[model samples]
Target: MSSHSKSLGEFDLIERFFKTGANSLRTTADSAIALGIGDDCALIRPPADEEIAITSDMLVEGRHFFAGADPELLGRKALAVNLSDLAAMGAKPLGFTLAIALPMVDKIWLEAFSKGLFAASYDYSCPLIGGDTTAGPLTISITAFGSSPTGKAIRRSGAKAGDDIWVSGTVGDARLALAALRHELNLPNADLQNIAHRMHQPTPRIELGIQLRGIASAALDVSDGLLGDLRHILKQSQVDAEIQLNQLPKSITLQKQGIGIQNQFAASGGDDYELCFTAPSTQREKIHTISKILNLPLTLIGKILPKKDVEVRIHLLDASGIELSNSEAAPFLNSFDHFAS
Candidate 1:
């Protein structure tokens, strides 16, 4: 055969190239067929007394992430991003399917990507079930299945007026990472690297979600900006929230950057996988106890108010109950348009 004579088409590519040694994931009965890897439809059975929560996310090139993102991180993020959605619903991750559109067949790229995917899979005790490979501009779409006891899943609609608005951990690290990546501002190398890593490798709050199943009336992972996402909970829960900017969590790295003590980053910037949730005011002590037990920081940032005429307006109040509104200074809920550019 001549060096130029190449006739490996789609089917040949699938059989000869894609279906090599499998990644560390649960296969169908065939070991290689964990969920019918080659068939038109795949089937699997769920355990008794458990319901499945399925979610999908698409990471596009030159969009969701930069083109030169570490392939391993991209792969890990591809699955982790979807898992965050499941976590928001208080589901325990099971397995995931990868649908990748690649520009070419590069073994090194695949190896690194597989490492990233498997690292997270093992960490979460979830596995990769199956996937499809294709040629394109490199978009990775992952659909994940997680489980929860029947009728016990948390939802975004469960929030009620008078519930406490809470957020876990710190926020805006990922956005700060993105800003550093683009060199929009100057920062120390260590902090810059940390921020960038947060943007690339987000840790989904899976355990906390499971722990808060009964307590959280409504919950969601803050993938978008905080103001944008909390507004989502407010709208779905049909309640308004009075956000006291002083109460939001802040990272020391972020604070040192002079973002201010007002918690502006957590209030406006996004990419914090921290769960923003709502619970009745009575659950406050239990929530604090959960945080202490788990060693996770739980900050009560605000409170859900009755569906007032002034909805979606996150008030910035000072110690003396002084309210501040500065739309011109800070554009609330700008992530959609911010990323659109």
Candidate 2:
């Protein structure tokens, strides 16, 4: 042992106390980490002829996630959520950094979390390039990086008044999962288990995002609920949409549960991890075709409209094939105002 060795102390709290950055066991992408650990700054090279896309997030205990959450899943989810942002920009996966704070070193928890981190990181081919660790409330802040050919990246400002809007996957899974966790709703054991999985393991649609680079006029991830996230695109594109209520992808179980459509669970409840995008009406078939090839379902839910602000028109049909709207039937979206205390 070296003379510089310091006692870890009981509870290993001393070492954890001094470990003021990402733990040493983190998978370090040594090649790109030209100046790792103890360095003032880090440097990396971008892909040739491509522009870099960057996104970050802070996963805080009690705020962003639960305190009793499994550490391994937390590690994976922290990365997945950030990558979803990069995916929305139609960028290829590159790498990420983690800054984790923990109250104490629990080997079991750390091992499980490290396993999850490495599993997902390697699966996505995104290496853990670098980061710092510290002693504080349990929190994991991740910063992800990606690159796309210059001028090929997707943005939230390309929708036109006549464009069609689409979404991948269903909505309300995460919020429903949270509800299950809280026992606010007594669902079947199998159902609750499924929801829990979605909450813990969100799959970011990176490949689909890449494929939609040229096809989608605008795109964003449905993280903060469909309505809230869609509003971001609407505002950026300076357009409005009349999304059909019945066209939304609701889980069959969610439907059988008789969860009222008025809840707009597909619209107001968020964290679905789906991609909502817009394309010319002519491209609708193209979108579905690619979806078939990719084995990912993409649904055409509505059309962009000429309006001053974003307004959703739910359930647009009658016996005579005329548009219809009722206070109880048309559960419009109010993402910004929903669940605001």
Candidate 3:
């Protein structure tokens, strides 16, 4: 495969593999894309009354995935994470551009990767309009475009004191998968596969985000650890929060773990891709209705509080709703830091 791919020029590679996939993504007559691949630049026409929401994410080999990881899964995840960003903003996906760097053009690898990429594109109605493929270390960077009603896009600064803090779907399973893969933990094969799927293929809550437009005050998807990502909201909103450690929604697989493991992973694990949002307490019933309508679990874990002295504190609480001391909360505060040694 490598020998055959080596004979193919870069332009030929693009035309043979990625171009067809991009062309097929223009299945909708009302697609925002005016032109796709083989152009100097892709054209788009967004509705005048709507605002464009764009996000980009880069996945580097070794840093983001294991060497020799399934290219198909990698392809899906590269796009899924970007879509998750759109979901965070309560926007509907329109299209995307992919810029990929490859060590070599392996036809087998390209086939699987393109399959996965187009699957997500078709599922989310996010067409691939343009991209650049170059020779380098394997890396995928995707920039996704979405649209939302003007003035209706959710922001991190809108969370107010007295708002209820909520999270959609479960957390921590992905961390458990990572731990097991790194040999930091041991697990049954069944459990490992289940949790690993969560780590590799995350579902972006696009519909939920769209429905929460007027209801949620502030929202973001959990890619970094929940606490760390939620801090962005706190800092922007200038508010504090108290979260019940036990109230964090977890998969049954995660719940079976020890208390310390549960707390650590659920609070600080990255790549959950679930939604963490804030809404007024008065909308609790409406939130519940949305949850049922979407058939997704929405857990209320905390409340926004008035910021004191410009310090945005995240008070950790026990199952009984008693606040824990700094000493007791210290262990659960550690989150993934890219530059940390």
TM-score of each: 0.88, 0.83, 0.95
Q: lDDT of each structure?
A: 0.74, 0.72, 0.87
Arranged by TM-score, best first: 3, 1, 2
Candidate 3, backbone clash total:
0
Residues 141-260 of candidate 2 have per-residue lDDT tens digits of: 888888889999999999888899899877777777776677877778888776677778888899889999899999999877786677788778778776666677777656655546
Worst 10 residues of 2 by lDDT: 1-10
Q: Which candidate, 1 or 3, has the higher TM-score?
A: 3
Largest lDDT belongs to which candidate? 3
Per-residue alpha-carbon lDDT of model 1 for 1-341, expressed as tens digits? 00112323642453333334233344232322236344554554566787889999998888888877898998788878888998999998877777777787777888788778777877776666667666678888888888888987899988887888899888878777776677876779988876776777888889889988899999999888777888888788777777776667877788887645225566777677889999998899999998998788999888887885755555556546677667632654455333557
Q: On a 0 to 1 TM-score scale, where does candidate 3 land against the true structure?
A: 0.95
Better of 2 and 3 by TM-score: 3
User: Per-residue lDDT tens digits of candidate 3, residues 226-326?
Assistant: 98889999999999998999999999899888989998899989899999999999999999999999999999999999998767889999988788899
What candidate 3 gets wrong by more than 4 Å, as runs, is 1-8, 338-341
Clashes of 2: 6
Per-prediction backbone clash count: 3, 6, 0
